[model samples]
Target: MARILSIVFNPSVDISCDAESVQHTMKVRTHNLKQYPGGGGTNVARVVAELGGHAELLYLSGGAVGSMFEKLLAAGSLAGHRFPIADETRISLAVREEQTRREYRFVPEGPVVTTAELQPALDFIADYGADYIVASGSLPRNAPADTYARIAAIASRTGARYILDTSRQALKSAVEKGGIFLLKPNVGELESIEGTKLDEEGATRAALAIVRRGAAEHVVVTFGREGALLAGSGGVLRVPARHVETVSAVGAGDSFVGAMTWSLAEGHSIEEAFRFGVAAGAAAAMTPGSELCRRADVFALYEAGSRTIN
Candidate 1:
């Protein structure tokens, strides 16, 4: 049983390319195309590996695309297994323009995996050994929101805690199970959940509200470059990120979640884990590619310049 298991319902095979410019409603020339296995959970696994922690990526697998995903995971020396599905996996591309310093991306809906495919996958995860489970991203068509909720329940039955991140009914159901220790929801997603406009204050308020509701014991409201606010037993701890040059915005949030989970698994306190996440997010922001961060970079940023939002 790996200590960390990341699950993604909708996985992607990302092929990113750099383009000259992204003018409104116009075709543009692009270069520097590169492809790799993608999706939130896979990204988490990569970051965990970079941080010297153990993580296994469990995702829907089948067809050639699924085979490609398996190959990619194997290349990283990370353990990966497949779930049989009918549809071939989907693909996406990020086109970065050098002239205007802009990027345009082509994204497609991932495979619509069926319930038949999902059950065995869940069964496989039930046998997995992990201290913490990180479930992130959107549900493919036919996956009920509580899909993660059931998995979270499985983790609890198996003696492992889980961090659930997703939007809508899934988010609601997972919180209902009441075993989730930490949850990270963006402002928009939280807004949709609470049925109100969730701005900065509203986001924090929502975090406290969820805590009061007992869906989650601790909550972190991520505000992109604005930093993240933590809502726990001791109230909110605002972790303001230090300024850093950004090459690409891909996987910044995922890096933060992975790092925070890794730190806590490594026996750091909540405050220490918060700092670890801030540095990890900054490290990913400074990296040029997707879901890439070296442990050295995270530690270096931590020592040189990370600060709490006091």
Candidate 2:
């Protein structure tokens, strides 16, 4: 089994519920309230576990909510390492509109972190020996923008392949620093990093540009419903999307990253893993609320695309 370490700098307790319609200044009644230990890295770890893979999650925890978060992780039986902090972990909300099937997500900028707290987290990651180190999600407020870049440096030093999925300057700083094994960026994020708009062709070129510049070994650019582009030294492989009845869009990106990493760790080719990723992303959309891709749904979609995936 591949030893995977997922680091969550800005963790959350995800709360999701459904309402008939969303209106301003009106008391809305929601049904089926669901809560989960959430954050980019935690979601990735959960997806890996759902896919029958083992991943150890490392996240910052504090306050009452942080204790609840720990219990939630325990409920799922996921292997989690909690690092202490003074601030409370934030909460993210996802509201599903039943009439239109739209999801409204409200994410808070996470708590501030002191340099003292930040350094220990970095040291823990640097010393840990894992086959793959995945750093996802946003950096907390007051945390340095180059935090992911520092983690990338640790990944290089430890000889672990690093997979980065974030946005804005955090993404740009890491890419500019180089040494990423794989970079997963959405269309808007790619545009932000390159400082320009990109069509499908433009996005492909930009992804290839990152690889050409030696910023990363592989670049996976997701184009929402259109599909995704996987570019690297070998070439670009376009993985088409599977049209499905989307219940909610939450967690789709994390599902894609987690499934792809799991597939690669299982010894599948990048092309094959990319196919699995697309399948997992589509599967995630088929479910409601913040719940990620179900294992059966992922397998079904993967097998459905097997004929054309290769």
Candidate 3:
């Protein structure tokens, strides 16, 4: 098994429920309330474990909410290492309006992490090197913008493939600093980095440019329903989106990153892994609320999609 470590600077307890309708100045009754451990890296780790792969999860935890977060996480299969912090962890909520079938999500910015609280994670990465190091999600307030870039450097020093999925300055800093093994960026994020609007052809060109410039060994740009495009040394490969009933969009991106990393670690080729990733992402969409892709759904989708891609 390939050793994988997933780092999350901001973690949360995700609560989701269904309400008949959301109206102002009214107490709306909710049903089927569900809670799960959530965050970019945490979700990725959960998805990896769901696919029968093991990934070590490292996350910041503190305060009363953090204690509850720990309990929720302990219910899952992932082996998590909680780094203590001073501030309370955040709680995110999603309420689905039954009338419109739309989801309303309320997300907090998360706790402000100090330098001392952040250093332990870097130190841990240096000591517990793995085959792949995945850092996903947003940088909490007070953390440096180049945090992921610093992680990429540490991964380089330890000879581990670094996979980053983020947005804004963190994304720009890492891309500019280079040394990333794989970068998963949505179309908007790629556009922000390149500082321009991109059509399909332009997106492909931009991805290829990043590869050629040594910014990232591989770049995958996700285009929601249209699908995703991969650019690397071999060239660009495109996979169309799988048609599925989207119950919730949560965790779809994390599923892609987790499944792709697992497939690559399992000795599959980059092309094969990319296909698996698309399948996992679609599978996650098929699920309800914050629940990720199911193992059966992933394999079935992958096998079905593989035929068309082949």
Each candidate structure's TM-score, on Cα atoms with residue i matched to residue i, is 0.93, 0.98, 0.98
Highest lDDT model number:
3
| Full candidate order by lDDT, most accurate first | 3, 2, 1
Model 3 ranges off by over 4 Å: none
Model 3: lDDT of residue 71: 93
**Which TM-score value belongs to model 3?**
0.98
Tens digits of per-residue lDDT for model 3, 138-257: 988898999999999999999999999999999999999999999999899999999999998999999999999999999999998788999999999998998888888688899999
Name the runs in model 2 displaced over 4 angstroms.
none
**Model 2 lDDT, residue 64, Cα:** 90
lDDT of candidate 1 at residue 168, scale 0 to 100 = 81
TM-score of 1: 0.93
Candidate 1 lDDT trough over 10 residues, lowest sum: 301-310
- Which pairs clash in the backbone of model 1? 1-129, 19-96, 145-170
Per-prediction count of colliding residue pairs?
3, 0, 0
Model 1 C-alpha lDDT per residue in residues 40-147, reported as the tens digit of each score: 788877778888888888888667887887777787787776677898787777777788666667777677777888998898788987788888877777787679
